[model samples]
Target: MTPWTTLLVPDILRRICEYQRGIYEDVVPFRRFLSNGATVHGTSKQAQAFESVLSPWLALYPSISRLVASYEPIKHALACHCAYTGRAGILQHLHKRYILQSVAVNLCQMAIAGQRLDVLEYLVCIGYELPRQFESVYLSWKDQAVFDFVFEHYRPLCTTNTTIYAFASSGNEDALMRLLSYVDEAQIRLMWSVAASHGHVELARTIYTASVDISDHVYQFAGSSFFSTTFQHIKNAANVGSIDGMFWIYDIANPFFSQEDRIAVVGFCLKYAVMENLWDRVWTLLEQADGRVDYPQLLACLPYFKWPQDESNARSMLSSTPALIPMFCTSWLPTIKDQAKRRLLEEELMSMAVLYHDGDRLEAREWLGDVDEYYFNAMEWLMDEYCIDKSIAHDVFQGPLGVAAMKRAIENDHIATMRLLLKYGVQIVPEYIFRRGGIRAIKFYLDKVNPEFTIPVDLLVEMASTPTNDTVFQIVHRTWRARTSITIVHTVESQCIAQAEAHGQVNIIIYLAKSFQSVHSPSEYETFLIQHVQDFYCAFNRARHGVNQLFAIWNPVLDACFNVEFILESLDSLLALTEENLKRLVSLSFVHIPTELIVQCALTNSVLAWRVFCILLDAKIKDKSSRMELQRECLVKKYEGRKFRNVPTVDGLGF
Candidate 1:
């Protein structure tokens, strides 16, 4: 499916360009009706504008039956907008729909491809209500085995699922049952499992079946987090009074056995159930176990056995009451590989819930923080060697309250730790991290410590000069090979310009802007600047909600400088200032440029990209001759290394 990005609304402008009619006048009249939020996005404007151009496409009542036979354009549009996240959302939303339609189909296709549920639901509603005859051939639900039969021909009349993954994970019985008619069986199973694990108790109960297999495949796919939660839900069921669920668990889960894992499973089940005063049931289960149990099992059972006797019955069970011990029985705590040993240990640990210093790792984990390395070690050992898979470790490591790992790395100032995490796919600056913390740690690491991880200088210069009158301009202007990740957090381009402008770093500014232009069309940059006219102008609405005062301090080269005095004499003619100006920016790099001046040139544009980006990529600068050749193409001037200042220095002097 083509993205809405395909027919860049800019194309409409192009279409208008070929006409001699009063197009701008017509658009200008309705401009007052556009969005009031901000001009840069023009999101509201685009919506209004689209209604006129696209309304005719939606004139018919039927929507899905008219989706474009080809989806290339919508697909292309979204890709252009950097809307990959949107596409994934859409696919999960309307994947069940089938119709040889045009307008509504295009919207649905885009909605599904972009994973846009809101748009998808809206389109689907339109498709279903404004009824149309869907080509019967296209309405084949037979091939779409995932969804229920009704959804094959049309979307459901109502959309209770607001989130992309919401209905997919609804624990509500009615919702799940209703949703089954719309989505695939596998999807329904996943939704049920995910919802159940998330503590949607009623929903989980509604979905769980006596015959359903506890799938190892599902466990592996959902990861330990899901299973851990599922286990927690099972433990909580009896406490909550779900009779059907409790009986179902008892009937399905043979938590005890005589020959094998009986004690561990039975003890765990009893812990939750007995806590609620189900004494008779407990005694019945214990009697059922009979001769299969041992002294420890008997002791564990005695707690509830005497629940009829007194609360001390639980205490008696916990102490192992020396009187209950056989003459030959060992009194000391035991550890072993078999379930018998584990069952005894689990009882001991549970016993410690009221006592202390059991020397049992699980007990210690509950009572203390991670201050003890010994406990952590025991935990690691239990997890790695005991569990068939290392899933248990993942379970113990959640709740994420303290980022001990990140904190430890910061304290040690360990570059290796950072690399290791990167290798393990831990993001130091995850998007959420930046949103909450706002690069404080990153800034500290970059500015204070001379950590071994540094980015390239040209990128900095490009960013520095891009935003005029920026604080900490000196940091950006330095022509260094290594820099920390702090500077690249935002506005690498603008920062380069800010840095260059702060230090009169023209060469850097030119290179950086130009580099930004090459891969993306130059017109895009121009459009962005025009769109952001107000953001660049705080005091004056350059376009609206402009950024700073400087962009408006025009060199008279621009036809309409926003609020600042126009340097009419100094300004280059507006025509001469085309998208070609974008060729002056530079990208971030790690490689060291030989001459600081050469480095400066690299920051200006694609012309200098040869030296800096290549160096950044390969970790080595290009040969002097090749660099000089690139310098010539980018600068549009001859290079005699020393002609300007010095052969090696980018600065005006002969460093």
Candidate 2:
């Protein structure tokens, strides 16, 4: 029996309808009244907003025919999806079936989003009213073809600067130039400000070239208390890190401002560029200022450039501008409110300098204001010629500061430096060191330390799960095997797998799953498999519910399990591929599941099976793999002799 013919079976249809109703219970409250296929006028505003938000999700509906039979308010929503995905046949079916009204506005926008001119032309032919809010449409349209089509067909009324501003914000220079012909030359200030603020450098340049200067033109800055008579747009461009636009404005307005005003402008650019971490712009502004900027005030903005996140740029600042570190130490460090964080940043700065250049540089030594700071700086550079003298080594290694410096060395994976620290009797908590350090440091520590101080198994698991510590994790596994007395406890193993999956550590998941199976009987391992899968699902569902959809899409468990044969085998054994579960898997937005597996598990007791079948078909189409095609042929051969009815034929597989 064909798959689509099987969908026509009454029992299958009823089962699918029940499943869809259960899955979409949250969408029921958003329904609008439909009278003779036309939308009624008096729905609540909240319902309308819900409809807009649910439109994209509804397009992912498994059964379009079932959707038409049961849900009425969402038919137009499906229309929007059809336009977005460029499914002309589905769109034509929806239009002929519903006579969808009050839809031209969204259809036009959807066509623009999808970059579908054919859909737009179809809408225009159907006599739907042209959209009146051209600014919204123009603001979103990026394709030149769609822009020209709308421009030529609709001929937007440029009665307000809002239209010009939206067009400029889209960064379509050709379209903006065409739009400027309709706008008055005197009212281009708003357009220019929007362009510059949004980093549309070319659009801002084009607008500035065509604008007429008014003697009394006082450009009012929105959402700010100040107004400017000259070069306000230049500052706006700088605020958004628009380097090209800033230079263009500087070239035109340089002669108009006084010396102090010029310094102020460059200083403003330097401050924001540092905060935005625009290193190239920062260097350009510093060079252009020609040593006129107040170094102390500039150093105060360093905190805004986030540490570790922008550590590379901070290092670049140190290398390119030699005066930055010196000024930061003398002027900025004293004013920082959090002295502890300030000291850490100070240590990292010195270590970074030592990383890039010789640690004996005078400027690096000068930044070490205190005795402890000197010890920390020397630890990173203490090799061969830069070795510390024996006289003070004992006192330096015995203090708590030395312990902190040791931890830093371990975290940085500085094996030679770590050996030096250990040589001088620097104290370390073995468990803490093992958790953070990589393989080389861990192996060195294990080899040097007494055997009785072997790291605990729990710490081993924690080490294995730490993000970006894969090499250390491998050594951890080997360490476990080396100590034959340590038994793998069930709870500890589960925790290791869960955390590794959460962090997306693929290697750890495979190692643990396969290793556990190897050590236990099939029956015992089956129970373990069931519990592990349950824990993963519970954790995954909790994460999906608590966080935004974008966050859930990157949930590490998905990547951790991707292409792992053990996980696929576990999922297959559990028969866990139901419609709801399939949807959850698809939302990962990555790989496609096996088609044969979906046929085996997703269609169980699903009388109206086409919806679930369609999802599998969609996944297969996207898979684009000849292996998946072979699997489909296998599935067809397996089910070909069954007496299913009314199922739709798949795209590639003939019924």
Candidate 3:
């Protein structure tokens, strides 16, 4: 009917040959929406609107290609919007071919409105000068949104003060570049001043090099955020000529920088110190401050900086040295309300450091510095916070202390404190207090510290036989015997059995073996037998029906820790397996497998299983792969050792 309508609608409807529309919104006629394009490569119902406009003109050109070049951009833009923006039934007569600038401006609008960059980049290559907003798209979404808000609100092309200042305040170098193209020289100058005032030196440098009058145009807004940020930007500019420009700003507004801004200025000056490393210029700043910069930074490198005081050289000189870190230690002890209390706290800390500075074991162990309280207080001070703060003595000191305090606690037989401390890095070197208290406790850290901090094993053994305070050396003999290299297993065995008989501390053997493992691998059967032997002996050592709850509880803890897998591979484990499980060992050997299967098949007795596991582990440590795989397979198969012989079946036995 109209020139914009196409006859293809009739052809497509004829091909459909059916009308199917449903009452439900869920169902709609499909033929009306289907594309009937067959010969056309890129044209479809999606482009039907543009095609309708083209249909009337088609007889004049007689070929689609003749008119395609002029209409491509509009089609692509519409297609992109329809596909991505979820808009439908757009106008069909969009012109495709476009001048670069028009397309670029259109793309710039799209980019600022949050369109994807890939689509914008396509527009750029096809002849768009590519607006800076597209580049700022690479930044974070918040930055892009902020820039968009400035551009949308300001209307920069009209050259208003609000628009110019908004762009300057936005801190978007890309958006500022776009603004420069449309705005007047005076507007740009105001922008430069605002940027400089805001510490955006980099942005100012970009604008100045792009041929705007740097000095002449920007001076009208001399006292704004632009002024300050501009000077810093110019100073940071890579070109040597920009340096002179930055200094010129400094001459006019030297005191304009705020106190915090001055710190930034100081930092910038320090950054340039490599040029004049002799420290002559820096010394002047320090003298002006009377050597006290008062920045609260402990490592502030300016030594001459001090609180304005006359001739405190001796104190000031050493303050530059790092040993003065102790001067800050008073700041370390937890919290105090009054500044006067803080001074008192620092005094106490300096005195504490002195008391512990020498090799006083007790003082070293009783480390008074409350690191936890200090940490929490530092965190609180940062947040300008308070937490109904606990008393310094009760919250910090009265509670179990840190790692260093644990040593003193153990030395003093402070059991609960020692356990809490053991959870951390603080170690217990057995040589110090192995005789007096739980001797295994010394072995706790000894095994870990053993390789690096070597302790004499001979001394440990000797101490067991002859110790200070007439205390027996519990760990020395047991530890030395479990080692692969010690070979002195019998001596410790005899000593342990005798001690267990004499003092009835039979469980000491198992505890000793556990301690010994940290020093060396348990290689010997007899050495591993320690736990089993202790277990066997403990049953007799018990009074009657049930074990003492104290010992029973300790037994389960040991049981949970004892590795049954290792025990299953040992000779002892082999003897203890079910008779049938042991018979399967022969079959496994025929299949070129290990006999450990038989040992592992046995029902696990808590003590026996653990001890054997340790022995077998020592054997397995030498080979990790093939054996490990087989062990895994055995576990997966649940192949406990073989069953007993079935009435001497010769056929099954392969007789």
Candidate 4:
């Protein structure tokens, strides 16, 4: 036979055994599979190759068995597997070798946990001492057969109270009854406490029945304060939807609770009843309390209640208390989205207000402050439904009330409400409307409310500068059209043109430029156009120096000047300028053009480049000199060399 060294050295085998032992400790199912039959089939390719390498080594090195037997992890795993799988043969072999001593108690626990009576008996026959808390483990199992066997064979390891409490808490009726033969009244009361606290209603009832005096235990359980085991049990019962358990403690067990406890109990029941939509139960509890409970305290609890499934019952419960109308209006009405339900709530509120105020509008209006949103809703409701006089409705919208209502209406974009307030002689500032009412509301005011209203020039300029909507520009245009005096047109035209140029509104700039040209002479038009181009160039350069280079590119006035047709026409108007003014315009226009773009154009299209160069040359001729002509010739020759070099060669022949 081949020696184990041929397969692997002893050190390598020892390391492999150590790794397997570590795995055996943490992985129970894998340990069970190893003990059953350490077989590997249809595994991954890597696992198959690993097995092919390790199997021969493991077989040859039977010293691994002695190592495993002595190893703590392997001993534990074997004990657990034998106890769990009822493999007494393995347990007997391990015990004969004294390898099961380390895991004897754990093996007993596993046997009890798995209810393996045969393994337990074998473990006992092998002189395995049971743990002191073995009965605790036995009670947890709640298997009567195992408990009986453990009780008859093993000495009592746990007290009767611990046993009874465990049985009661586990809701094991048969095991609890079997243990009941040994429990006295105190233990029974303890069992009742545990059973009730754990939501074991039937077991609790049985224990309570077996107790001598239920009231003593109940009082002892409740202690001196409301935050006691009794209260906790009741609340837990309610939370778990165990109505019988909750009522058994509240009604049957302790009927004569204190006034505070009664109020608390009724409040809890009422809250649950309302949440569950138990209308009859809610009314019954309320009547039984008979005004003993604080209604506001009860009403405060209503918000914690869920929206009931049957909303009609919820409405009935709410309407049953007329004094809570304000609470409902302020607290609950806003959350309701259904129009019909809201209308129903409003009708209830209106009826309650009428009944309480005895048809006195001033009294009800005083009861509901004018600044409150609910008051406005009530006033609107009264005017619409009760046919209250418009003069009376108008009375509420005076002073602070009027301003508050108008502000809210504007904020909510309620145009109809604003119109209503205005009809009632409520004066509003146009500036306030412009500031808060946005462009639509501003337009509404201009077109419908007051056409003569004028926004300040500074504000109009600001609005034009960052015009979120084009309609603002249209509104400013309308204002300009309405008053076309020379000064007004010039001011409006200059502001609009500056803003349009700043925002890269080329189309708007073109339109304004045409308008300005139509109203002014050619010289005035040329002067204003140059001023606009200069302003745009200054703003663009300032933006380029800041973090707004992208804005600079988008708002480049040179691009606008080239793209806008009306701008070209305006530039044509400048064709008859003085020599100095032409030079200035040509310099300003070329200053903003990127040099790289000019070079690319000069190389790719020499004709266009020459045309631009000739234009510049003509503009510079006011102080014509030989130096200027020589410099222009040098620039032309430089571009010509670049253009010729860019031409492709076809078969060594330039194309």
Candidate 5:
């Protein structure tokens, strides 16, 4: 084989290995094929290829061992693939080729991981010893048959309680029963711990029945159990809303748990119960606690209550605890007839909303219905209480609560809240609306504004600086034209063109230029037009430099900063003018045309090169050195067209 083809052999093998291992998610074999009615790690075709193709092919050469020795990871990976895919033929071939003493353990581990009893047997047949104290191997199999095979033939020693725990947790009853005969009392309790934590109640009952001298009370098992297994099962069950499992474990393990453990368990259960909207469970747990709880701790849990799912239930829950109603719950606010209590709930709800900027939470309670004024009162309370503690002040708000809320709505992209705020006559800073609210918010605001109100020309120009909805510019121009003169319109379009050029908004410049062309003759705005085109050429040069600095990162920020070739193609309509028009514009501006632009223009379209490069010469923008280089490059191009006489020199040409 050629050297290049030979060098690619390892990489090719690795890719094949990856394919067998299902590393490529988009590949056909991995997604479509299944093994034993489950998603396959390796397809049958992969196994056949390993056995029929790769194994026999490698066997023909003694250099196969050298290749395996050179790339050790690939060798191990190949071995793993063989064991995992149950390709015993290739595995035997690999053993015959390269069986290093150190690699035997890894091969055995992979065999066990393969969950194939035959592969394990083959490794032993090849004189490889299985590791002593095989807890990991025991933990590996969820299949009962594999465990049974290991027990019948191999029976590797067990050192820790981990094997039984894994068996119990995996719900392998047959494996756990077989394992129960071997372990002592400590390991037996550990098995019970796993069963209790995982809610394997029948398995726990089986262990209690099978084991001798075990008490009916679970505290006997709990004392020697893992600490996390003891206390955490309660929280785990509570978190998953497994009330039966939680209470069963609680009733069993109650004697062993400390006061702190009980508090943590109750707190965690109460919090999730509230969030899960388990009202019956919440009331029952609260009644069982019977004022043993810290009121402040329970009050803290009230804020997280799932108010949206059952608002009436939440109201009743809050009303049952009247003091917390004044603190956290907002559902009761709509029903509270007392003015003082209504104000208190309103202040608390809005304070939480403003502090968290949680629009969904605030919206859930319908607190914004007639409470427009209360939003500011809430902001004040936040400033005095919450903000003051953090050394923050009222300056966080732009103006009134409604305007602040409107800004928050814009930031969070909450359109409904924005409309509601606007409907309530919340005045907003027009620039902030244009900048942050984007086109949709701008349209909403414009639709709500009085007919006489037009967005300020300066703000419109600012918006035009970046790419925004073209419809906004059209609307502003259409509205502003009726009140203003053609001269003022020309000036507005000119400033917009300048802003668009400065920010490299090629499309916007084209749009504004087309709009300007419709209104007036080109000659009337010749100076302004020339300056705008010059600014574009300069901006393009900066964009090229900016692109070199920030490589491979693409986003809107990058587009705004470093828009390149697409800008050239997009601006063709505005820039592809006649030669004389281009020359006159370039000459009037007095800025140097970039030589790179000339070269790119030549390459992009040779016809447009004449129009663009002629301006470079006529404007005296091409310096003597650049002129010589361009001439020399042209001479070389010209000479290369035929049998060359001699290589051209810059000095040979007349200066």
Candidate 6:
């Protein structure tokens, strides 16, 4: 091989020499050029020179092999690169040049860290070994395969406390089991604190059970303070709502917690249970505390309760601590910022007073002295429970309170209370009656209370627009009966017809259309039909009943419009209309009817076509006009083209 100096020109040599001066200044770029130089034209002398310059840079770039491989001394950099990149082939090349004990040790650590099984096997094949403490790195990496390989092939390394800590902290039970064969009791006990910190509950329990003296170990591990000790493990379980872990710690380990600490634990557990609305667990923990937790402590944690709107939870909490009611009635109720929560609390207190205290008139009176403020709220609850006395009912029905209370009663279907309020001279609010009370209540009030009262026309329209039952139609019919003005009656009638038709109410539509036609003027009826033609057709199409019923509802509008296109489009109506009605329609609107539509209808139903031919013949007989004759001829030719034979003619028609 040519010497490196002969391979390079003088300018390149000058660049290499300059590179040597600043080799330390810019190691990365210079090392890149040196690797290129060596690969292209390298000799033993240049390789030796490059080795001296590139040694310090190896620590900065362990993964870059070209920079490190340009040097021969410290060929371990090559092994390091091989191990780092999981390239075992390069390790074999370096092995031929030098014995790499340090490299082998580093390779084992890297294999464990990178989870490279091939590198580990290569090291073992080369008779390279690892120290005992290197197991800590393996344990920390939590790679069970590598740990097992190292443990089985290598002589058992003495397990250290740190290794045990890493095993427990990682929550790897299998690794800890392997270590347990060599670890002492004291070292295993030290593992508990870390296990607890990492929420390794099962591992901690295993440690406790395996101990020769668990109580001493648990006491030592739990230490003196509640906040800082391993007792936090139990508290952490409680915070996460881990019931099983908390029970495990309490039952198995039974650490020596101070009385204050015990109470703190109970409080934490209760707070979590209440926040989660786990009433069963809350009661369990409360009973376990055995009355150690006071009312004030629970009240301080009231914000944690999730269901402030639930009456059952309020009752449960109040029933748990009855003594708190007096304070809740007087102090807490007024101080609570959430009115909804305060109202629920008051309702529960009132119910309890009624159930437990024999109606406790004085306490009830004090609680309800602000009656006007909470009158509706109190009345609603009392009326629902059937516990309101006549005097309370009478007192609550004074002035506008009676109006408001009656409205609520009507909304809640409290007919008895409604009668009670009315008997006590509570006047009804007409709008409220219209809004809350349906037709039944309205009729009852109109017939029984005041016959002179009139529901607003807008209110009637609004109610008609809304979806209603059959009773609304009855109410509207009754209102039409009672009203005197024809215009208002027709307007209500027309709007109600449109609204009812929109909802596909066939019975209501029939009744309204019949009623409308009975009192309807020609112009008014025509205008109504014209305005609602689209809506009427839509209703007819979407009608749920049979063809006969829809015909009854839609016949009048069809006859008045006499629109041939519409009748042809509605195939159901075309087939269902009687021959007499079809004849009358054709006779009245023959000029407006198209020949194609007539042809289609005749092709569909030939008997109807014969009737139309008779009508056209009757028209031609009466007039004998050329246009009528031409129309007759065209329709006759179209019908005859179908080859429909044996058609009967109307006997009454003279052609």
lDDT tens readout by residue for model 1, 546-602: 112233232121333333222111112111222233111111132122344444434
lDDT of 2 at 17: 59
Candidate order by lDDT, decreasing, is: 2, 6, 4, 5, 3, 1
User: Of the pair 2 and 5, which is ahead by TM-score?
Assistant: 5
lDDT of 2 by residue, 236-260 (tens): 6666667566666565555555666
**How many clashing residue pairs, candidate 6?**
0
User: Number of backbone collisions per candidate, in order?
Assistant: 90, 14, 31, 0, 0, 0
Q: Rank the candidates by TM-score, best first.
A: 5, 4, 6, 2, 3, 1
lDDT by residue for model 3 over 1-655, one digit each (tens)?
3311222343322222233212111221222222332212223333344444334434332232222332333334334333222222221222243333432234333333343444444444445443332233222234565446435543432245554555565666776777676766556666665565555656766776673443443333334575465555545431343333343344334455655555454444432331334244444434332333333333343343332231233233322222333323323324345666655444333223212333434233342233323322332332232222323322223332343455565455554445443433445545555654444345444454353343355555445334233223444554444452556554554454445434434344344444544555545433445445444334334323222331332333333333333323344434454434433332221222235543353224455554443344334444756545544554444434656454333233221
Candidate 2: segments with Cα more than 4 A from true spot? 1-11, 14-71, 102-105, 133-140, 157-171, 184-187, 190-203, 213-244, 247-266, 270-655
Residue 204 miss distance in model 1 (angstroms): 6.5
Note the Cα lDDT for every prediction shown: 0.36, 0.55, 0.40, 0.54, 0.53, 0.54
lDDT of 6 by residue, 16-74 (tens): 33445333223232334324223212222343444544334333343234333433323
Number of the top lDDT candidate: 2
TM-score: model 4 vs. ground truth: 0.37
Task: In angstroms, give how far residue 463 of model 3 lies from its true place.
Answer: 11
Model 5: clashing residue pairs?
Answer: none
Residue 234 C-alpha lDDT in model 4: 74
Alpha-carbon runs more than 4 Å astray in model 4: 1-65, 68-77, 99-105, 125-129, 132-142, 151-171, 181-203, 213-219, 222-232, 235-240, 252-267, 275-655
- Say what the RMSD of model 3 is: 24.5
Q: Would you give me the overall lDDT of model 5?
A: 0.53
Best by TM-score: 5
TM-score list, all predictions: 0.24, 0.32, 0.25, 0.37, 0.37, 0.36
Give the Cα error of residue 286 in candidate 6, in Å: 5.0
